[model samples]
Target: MATLSPEMPKSDDRKSSKDVVAKLNYVGEMHDRAVYDIRNPAGSNIVWDTRDVTIHDVRPHLDKFTMDTQGFAFVKLPSKFAENPELFEGNRKARHFVTDDSLDVQYAQEICDYIQNMTGARDVFPRLGGLVMRTSTRASAEKAAWAPPAEFVHLDFAPQAMQGWIDKTLAAKPRDLKPYSRVQLFQAWRCISPGPQDNTLAICDGDTVSSDDKVIVDSMTGDPSIPGNRWDSRMCHYSPDHRWYYMPDMEPDDLVLFKGYDSDVPDAMNAMHSAFQNPLGQTGVPRKSIEARILAFYD
Candidate 1:
């Protein structure tokens, strides 16, 4: 169960003294289990369970936050992506990023190289990557060529899904001769804006989350019929001990690295994350960002 407050914090409130509103996944209904069918092409007939809105005083708990402890870290790295910014143009890939264009493929590969150097992984493989833009309604945002910020408490992959992805994605690679026994999946996120972000990302401490609080669900692409297996994503039930943190005034050069799945130990499990509404954000220009999902093999 979660500790909730009815009071909401104002935009001008101080970070150390104020509370922030969080839209959390609520799963106390009288159902055998929670599941939704997301297999639709026109962005119609989508079934996303309703979430509960609650105000929380995150200031006091901010002291407990850390990348290793929370499964996320804020790292500063300057990149030359602005020289080829058009690589993210169009929704041709739709919903999620599809790597078809040669330029887009090159861009993803470059990101994979960056991840390898950042994490010092023995080997890194570039997987699916995409740009998410904030536009229109929150519900309709994912279907847009430029998607909206995902405003919910969730993890990108489940254990089952993570295993399947590893077996399939690395089947052709040479066997590991090193003593490393596991693989880790990471998502590198960054802002593409010229200034500070009004809507920013929030991360939850994975250590505080128990197995029972995680609800595994399928995430279907816009076209549900092509490759029928549903992609796995975990919806989190709120808890009082769950600590959340975010980086304020982010620039394009800074990257937010987070663990999506780790095969080695429970302590290094996936990071729970969501985008929150920052009242202090500057208006007129929406937030633009890109996220790259990469796999790192450990020794």
Candidate 2:
């Protein structure tokens, strides 16, 4: 059962004066637990029923949220690809289908370097296998091998799942490697398509999220018979106190970094995010974006 924070302000009190309204899907009440089986060829079987609740934008109060405080921060750091698209041919080829070999290694390294510089971590590892490209346009979604925008409000990984990844990663390194005092998982997201996105990504403030608001679900892919085909993810139960925000007219140069998990900080804010319909309607091209998962180690 998700509990609302008594100290938090009511939803109505924090409503944006701009009248931006959209529906966000959240885990609905269920007697049995939920599971996401992507192995189903016909279509993914999402046993976790969801309810779409009307939510208002919090852009007017953007100043209230910060990377350290709310676990997400938006920036306008332009990518090299954005400046010189012709220089990275692999990035262009990725529009069709993204694979470890298809994505440019240089591009991935650049992002890793950017994250390292921004967070000042001793080391940063990019999960190349976790790189994903998503689109919202119907034509593009069908033609491209990429996935559509995710509509559910949820966190990417549960604590145990993240810990398992960390353990596995550390185990693969040399025995003589120095031990890190802290580790953080983050997702760096950016728009790849045109501006004025019709379906934008919205993030929930971590401070407003109660620990009880999360439900763990089995996130499965590929063959169910395979041992490594499953991992745990978190789904959120709707709460009135959850504050959501989104950048209105994001460009390809814009980037947002949000925390997924942090070691040595049990109560650290973990940004929960989802894609929602832009209530203002489609002003430009349908949203197409890329996201990269990164792990930062601090000694």
Candidate 3:
């Protein structure tokens, strides 16, 4: 059961018994764990980047990592990694996400070049024939009872943004791939709630707006009928076309290659969706309910 919110009384929670009903006029659902998007930093209501809060991932040695002025932070693997695995294991960060516009273009290009080199596609960029990303989705990955299943790992891939990136890459021509001289990228997100379509979100009610604004794919995971998060409860990532879709659950720093070019992947994703049918009977990932009582009860 959700803890009562401090914002208001239990009986006057107004929207739902599970909600706290903050003083804000909106009668939206509420729950500390009832998921929301973190794309806009305001979600946390906490200022500063990841460093502002020292909850987890605090550093004993700041010198071992690199954080430039643009807020692009990452650590390169040294040649001595194989020779000294114990010391070099912890300081590495895989994805140096370009979170700020004012960052230097050279830094982004440098990181991209490093990624290309690591992918074993040495000359694909800088004067490239082209770049291609083939994608595939594995449905019901949670059903398998593997001893090391992916319940704990971050669900880092969102489907909508992934499609957006796919569209972006396909439109570009085989231009001379100079180091990105004008590094500009548009960011947007849609707060998708699961509905009739598979993996696609329906606008809450009467909303019709979309743009380069950051999107919040408010995803639901695990079995939908169940009240709480199950083994598969998670949020995924979607990018237009980035070097690493996501690293595997292997080592802390081992960036695994995702198969982004397979044509049959999208069809497989639709087959498992819980539409029309009730989620209680669904065998795999549960569907979020739209019933007035079920939907708005949890924020």
Which numbered prediction scores highest in TM-score against the true structure? Answer: 2
Structural RMSD, model 2: 6.9
lDDT of 2 by residue, 1-299 (tens): 11112322333443435335678777777556567654343544444445444444544565566666688876556665533433223332332223344344445566778778777888787643445666675553323423457788888787778767666555543234358888888787887766667777888888888878887777766564653356788888888888777766666766777888877555443698988778664656777677777888888
Question: Distance from true position, residue 56, model 3, in Å?
Answer: 13
RMSD to true structure for each model, in Å: 7.5, 6.9, 23.5
User: Quick one: how many clashes does candidate 1 have?
Assistant: 1
Winner by lDDT? 2
Score each candidate by Cα lDDT.
0.58, 0.65, 0.20
What TM-score does structure 3 among the candidates reach? 0.23
How do the candidates rank by TM-score, highest first?
2, 1, 3
Task: State the lDDT of candidate 1 residue by residue for 129-209, as single tens digits.
Answer: 344444323342323444456666777688777766666555534345355677788787776664445566777667767
**TM-score against native, each model:** 0.72, 0.78, 0.23
Model 2 error, position 75 (Å): 0.9
Question: Residue by residue across 1-299, what tens digits does model 3's lDDT show?
Answer: 11112211122212322111111011122234424322232343211111111111111221221111111112222121222322112111111122223132222244344434433332332111111111112253212111111111122223333433333333432333334212111111111112211121111100111122122233333333532212221221222221111110112121111111112222111101001221122342322111000000001
What count of clashes does model 3 give? 19
The segments of candidate 2 whose C-alpha lies over 4 angstroms from its true place after superposition are 1-19, 39-60, 82-103, 137-142, 167-177, 225-228, 266-269
Q: What is the descending lDDT order?
A: 2, 1, 3
